[model samples]
Target: MTTITKDNITDSLLATVHPNGNSEAAQVIRENGFPTTKHEEYKFTNITKRIESKIQSFQQAKPLGLTQQDVSKAMIKDLDADVVVFNNGQFSAELSSLGEGYAVTNVTNSEAPFSIKDLYDDSYLALNKASFEKGVFIQIPKNKVLDKPVLLLNLVKANDGQLITPKLWIDCAENTEAVFIEQTVSQDEQAYLLNGSVEIKTASNSHIHYYRVQNQNNEALEVNNLLTDIHRDSTFTSFVLSLEGDMIRNNVTLNLLDSGCEGNMYGLYLLGGKTHVDNHTNVDHTKPHSESNELYKGVLADTSRGVFNGKIFVREDAQKTNAFQQNNNILLSDEATINTKPQLEIWADDVKCSHGCTTGQLDEEALFYLQARGIDKKQGKALLLYAFAGDVLEHLKIEAFKEYCIDLVQKKLGTNF
Candidate 1:
C-alpha cells in the first residue's frame, strides 16, 4: 500500500484508484510530495497553498450531467473540427464526434503507444498517473493528413469542492500531419481543482500543431502539464492562450531527440481581477542540426499576476543547434505584477542560443500616438494591446479558430478587433 500523508491535498486523494491497481505512482507521490514556494520551480507562485485553501476534500456534492444542447452552447462557432467531449473526468461517447482518420481508445483499456520517461521527479505528474480514472488516447496513422483539426473539449460542472484529473495521450506516426485544439470551460461558480496532463509523440517526418485555450470561471483552479518528444525530420508547434481562471499553471516540455527537428512555442495571456497565471517551458536539444523558437506575451490588469519561466538546453553533443526564447509583459494597473525569467544553457561551442525578457507598462508613446489620431484612451489602449498580442495570434493556421480567438481577445480587452 502507498501512503501519502504529506498534506491534506494528498490525503484527500486517498480514495482515487489507479486503473491497473498499481501503487508505483502513489509511492512516488509519497516520496516527492507536492511542490511548495521553497521549490525553485514554484518560487514565484505558491500554488500548493492556493489549492490547499480552496479545496479541503476531493468529494463531489452532486453530478451535473451534460446534454447535447449544453455541448452546442460551449462549442466554438463556425469552427470545423471533429469534437471529443469529456464531462468532468470521463469521456462522453454520445457527445463526441470522432472522425475516421484517427483511432480513439480509453487509456485504461489500451497500452500507451509510447512510455513516458522520468516519472520520479514531478509529484504532480505522479499524482495524475496515480489517480486519473479514464484518459483518452488518440493515434494518427502514417501518411494521413486530416482535412480538419480535432477539438478536445473539457466541461467541468462542479458545484462543490472536487478534484478533476484529465489525461490525454497522442501519437503521430511517420509522415503524418494533424492539428489538435484543447479547450477547458467551467460551468458553475463553485470551487474545483483540475489537474490535467498531455503527452505527445511525434515520429520522423511528422508535423503536429497543438493549441490550448484556457477560459474558465474565477472559482476554478487548474494545473496543466504537457510533454512532447520530437524525432528526426519532424516539426512540433504549440500555442497556449490563457484568458481566465483564479489560479492556473502550465508546464510544457519539448524534447528534440534527433536531428532536423524543429519546435515552436507561442503563448498569450490576458488576466484580470485576482487571477494568476504561470507558464513554465523547457526545450532540450540532444541532437545536432535542430532548432527551436519560443515567445510568450502577457497583459495584466487589476490585481492579477503573471509569471513566465522559459529555458533552452543544448547538450554537449548537440552542435549546430539554434534556439531563441523571449518573454514580454505589459502591466495595465498599479497593482498588476509580472515575474519573468528566460534562460539558456548551451554546452556545445557551435550552438547559437539566446534568451531575453521585458516587463513594463504599455508603450505610452504608442498610446499617445493613437490618441492623437482621434482615438479615445480606452480604445487606444485596447488597440495597442491587441497589436501586441497579434503577433502570436497570427500564427494560427485555422482561419475560423483564429477569428474566434480574436473575438475572445477583443471581448477581454473591452473592444472589437
Candidate 2:
C-alpha cells in the first residue's frame, strides 16, 4: 500500500481544479507539500496521514445540483433567517434567498477585494485559493441593520471520497449591523475532505457577528480558514463550535488594521470516540487603542484529543492595546488528552497583554458537593461540566444556536439541561 507524499502532491493536484503556469497556490503546494510530524504547528494533528488514507475518496467526489428537498435536511430548525446553500462548493440559487439590502453574486462577476498573493504562504489556504471552482460574494448595504440573521450552510452530498473548496467574500458597509451563521453538514458517510475559506472586510462603525459550526460525520475531514479585517471603530465577533468529525482544524485570523477596533473570538469543542479537533487562532493589533479577547473551552471523552494554540501579537505602533486570551478544558476519561498553548507577543511599550491555559478533570470536591445535595452522580458531573463551559456559551447572542448547543451537550452527556 503506497501513501501520499510531497512528491505526489503535484501529481494529485492535476486531478482537480489545476490552474495554469506559476499560480501561487500551485507553487506553494509544490514547495511546501503535506506537513509531517516534524512540523511544529502540525505535530499534534497528523493531517498528512489522514489525507493519505482518504486521498482516493477525495478524487472520486464531484459536485451535483441540489434541490429544495436536499436543502431541507440541513436547515436551522425554527430559525427565521435568510438561507444560502452551497452544494459541493457551488452556490445553489434555488436554495438561497437574498433579503432586503443584501446582494449575493458569483465572485467571477466582480473583482476580488483582497489579493490571494498574501495568503499563498499557507499551503492549505493556497490550495483552496487555486482550486476553488465556484464562490459567492456577499454585500450588506450601508447603515442597514438586519432584523434576522443570515444562514450560510455548506452541505456535502457526495457518496464517495471528495474534495470541496468553498470561497466566501463578505463586505459589511459603514454603520451596518449583521449576523452570519456558517454551518456544515453531510448526509454521506463516505470519506471526504473540505477545504474552506472566508474573507471579511468591514467598514468603519460596522458591527459583524459570525458563527461557525462543524458537525460532519465521523468519516469526514474538514479544514477551514477565516480572515477578518476590522476597520476603525468596528467590531467583529466570531464563535466556533465543533461537535463531531474524524479530524477538524480551524484557523481564524483577525487583523485590527485601524484604531478603536475590537475583535472577539470564542470556541467550544465537544468530543467523544476517537475524534480530534484543533483550533489555531491569531489576533494582530496593528493600531493603537485596539482590543481583542479570546476564550476556548473543550470537553474530551473516551480517547478523544483536543488542541488549541492561540497567539496575540501587538506591534510597536499598537500602543494602548489590551489583549487577553484563556483556554480551559476538562478530561472526562483518563485516556482523553488535551494540548493547549496560549501565547502573547507584545512589542509595544504601553500595551497590556495576558494569556492563560488550564487542562484538568472535573473538580472532585465540587462534584461531591453536588452529589451531597441529592443530585445523582451522573447528573452532578454533567452539571459541573456545563457550568465550566457556561462562560463561553453566554457569549452567544443567537437563541436558536444557543438552544441547539445546549441540547447537543445534554444529549452527549445523557443528562437533561
Candidate 2 residue lDDT tens string, 1-417 = 123465575457535644432276677777887667787878798876787766653452456766788777778777778888887777877788768778898764124556422322667787777777667888888988988899998878655437788889999999989889998888777777788889898999999999988888888888888999899999999999888889998889999999999999999998989899999999999999999999999999999999999989899999999999999998988999999989888899998899999988889999899999999998888888888877787888889978887777677766422
Each prediction's Cα lDDT score? Answer: 0.84, 0.82
Error of 2 at 80 (Å): 0.8
Residue lDDT tens for model 1, 180-210: 9999878888878788889999999999999
Error of 2 at 204 (Å): 0.4
lDDT at 254, model 1: 92
TM match of model 2 to true structure: 0.94
Off by over 4 Å in 2: 1-7, 20-22, 109-111, 116-120, 415-417
Minimal lDDT window, size 10, model 2 = 109-118
**Candidate 1 deviation (Cα RMSD):** 2.6
